[model samples]
Target: MNLVLRASILLLVLAGAPATAFAQDASDPIGNILDQVGQPAPATPTPPLPVPAPRAPPPAVARPTPAPPVAAPYPYGPRPQIAAPYAPSSSTYAPPPPNLSPSLAEPVFVDEYDRTPDRPMNSAEQGYENRMRSSFAAAQGMQGPLDGAWTLRSDAGQAVYTLLLVDKNNGRLEGAWRDPRRPGSRDSSGFLAAIQKIGTQLTASFYPSPGAGAVTLTLTPLGNGEWTGELTEGGARLGVVMSRN
Candidate 1:
């Protein structure tokens, strides 16, 4: 009988417990255990991640170097040298020879009468011989009164000129007219031409110089070694008188 009574008490005590205790045991048993032991609950452990393989480094690159630059040449070249001039020697100089002709070396003298004696005389020699003959004839009184030097005077009695009358061997006549008073006078000689005598009336042409025209004179004999004449030149006439000089 006592055992039956204890079983009945046990059934009654279970029925008296709360419904939340059963829920706690089913949802969190450790928490219920920790509640009974009066301690906190422990956290759960996390899992480790797997590691990846490392990649290779990128490839290295290479670069080339450039060549050195070239140099240039000059624009012009060097200049040339000059040469000197040439000169002659003293041995090449020489002088000319001396002159040897006879005319140059010695002088020649010729006589005035050395030419042919038989040849006809020139006018100069004939004139000189005529003067000599006239002088000789006057000394012998063989010539007329007109055959000598005469002094000619103008109308005013001033002596103007001198006149000479000569007779040649050929019966021709020649004369000279001289102006003695002129300064620097050189042998004022002239020649008579075309003389004509008609009974002491004489007419002749006189030339004062070579290549000059003739002057005409007409004369009449006056006694005692005198004569009167008219001298004409270029159609101009003048009375003149003459006397023996």
Candidate 2:
């Protein structure tokens, strides 16, 4: 109906218009009519497409930060060394000597006793005790048994010296003698040159001088804490007595 109305109006307009108007649109009369009628309403503006926000670059993949390298304490040449365990070499090993000294090389040992203990003194012991009391000078009773320091004197009471019988072990006796007149004088060493034991008598030889002959002394126990001894010096036998210090 609108088309019919529009056509009717167009016919009316054509009938009433001047030929000068018709000449202006003579070549495109239908097109001109339709163009005037087809003018569209103002188009509603289309919102711009979002463009998807560029996808945010896939969130940058969240790469992990690498740690800083550790600096070496001794970087250039010599590294720290670990100490190795001690190892003894075979070249330092030594074999001991065949025969070591008796004093040092001998391990400590105890000797067994063969005789009885505390037997009664024989008749010879009694006679010897009497001789010391009567004949030897400076003879006196001792408080205890004779074992350690004692003094040796001549029957005439001259040339006294100290005698130490402290080294008797296992029936083997060793002794040393010193002269107090000469301080620090090693008059006699305990290393006896010769010694013999017969019955209750002990014969010992002492080397007081390297070039001189040994001095011999024979000691007989007096059944007391002393010895009735004879000192033979230079082919002369002099009676002597030993008593506790």
Candidate 3:
């Protein structure tokens, strides 16, 4: 009975022991080991804090305006005038022959007689008339060897039945092609357009009324009252020689 009583007392003492005593007993061993190495006891582990979300990048900023490019100075100077397609020949067309005087080339104009009472001319009207006469005289004075009719023949010595007339006094040209074999058949005849003269060269443009395209002729004087030239039309080229008739 005494032994059972003693055992019951020991159980009661153990059951009544403070929790601090058990913790101290359990930590003593590790604490002693750390003390022996001169180190601090390890702290209890804590869960890692949630990582902070990355902050959004600041709004993009616009780039500054770049400076304008500077142009380089011209090495020589300002650009020069565009050159002519071809240099003008130094030789000029000769004056009209002595036989072809301005008086003989002047056009005659006949005015109808007015039956009404005659009126005195004013100063303005007289001045205009004088200017008109001066201009007419000047134009008539410019006519030269190119004023007469010309005949164009082929290498075979056959007449091409082509006739050309240049009226320098009126700045006009006309050409006609006919079929000599067929008495009254006419192929072409009209005034040439865009007549220009440069040195001894003459260029004339022609547009046939019934034809679909146009043609241009560039004629160069070959002296001796003759001219040689080329006609360009529709990508085709033809050689022509003309002599005064």
Ranking by lDDT: 1, 2, 3
In order, candidate lDDTs are 0.67, 0.65, 0.61
Q: In angstroms, give how far residue 11 of model 1 lies from its true place.
A: 99
TM-score of 3: 0.35
Q: What does the lDDT read for residue 108 in candidate 1?
A: 28
Off by over 4 Å in 3: 1-142, 168-183
lDDT of 3 at 13: 83
lDDT of 2 by residue, 1-245 (tens): 99999999999988878876767688778878887896877889999987765545555577789997765778564587879988777698554454442333323311112223334445777799678767533332322233456677888876556666633334555667665555544554344566656677877777665677778888888877678889886678889887876
Candidate 2: where is the Cα deviation over 4 Å? Answer: 1-146, 167-169, 186-190
> In candidate 3, where is summed lDDT lowest over 10 consecutive residues?
109-118
Cα-based TM-score, every candidate: 0.39, 0.37, 0.35
What lDDT, from 0 to 1, does candidate 1 have?
0.67
What's the lDDT for residue 167 in model 1?
52
Q: 167, model 2: CA deviation in Å?
A: 5.0
Q: Return whichever of 2 and 3 wins on lDDT.
A: 2
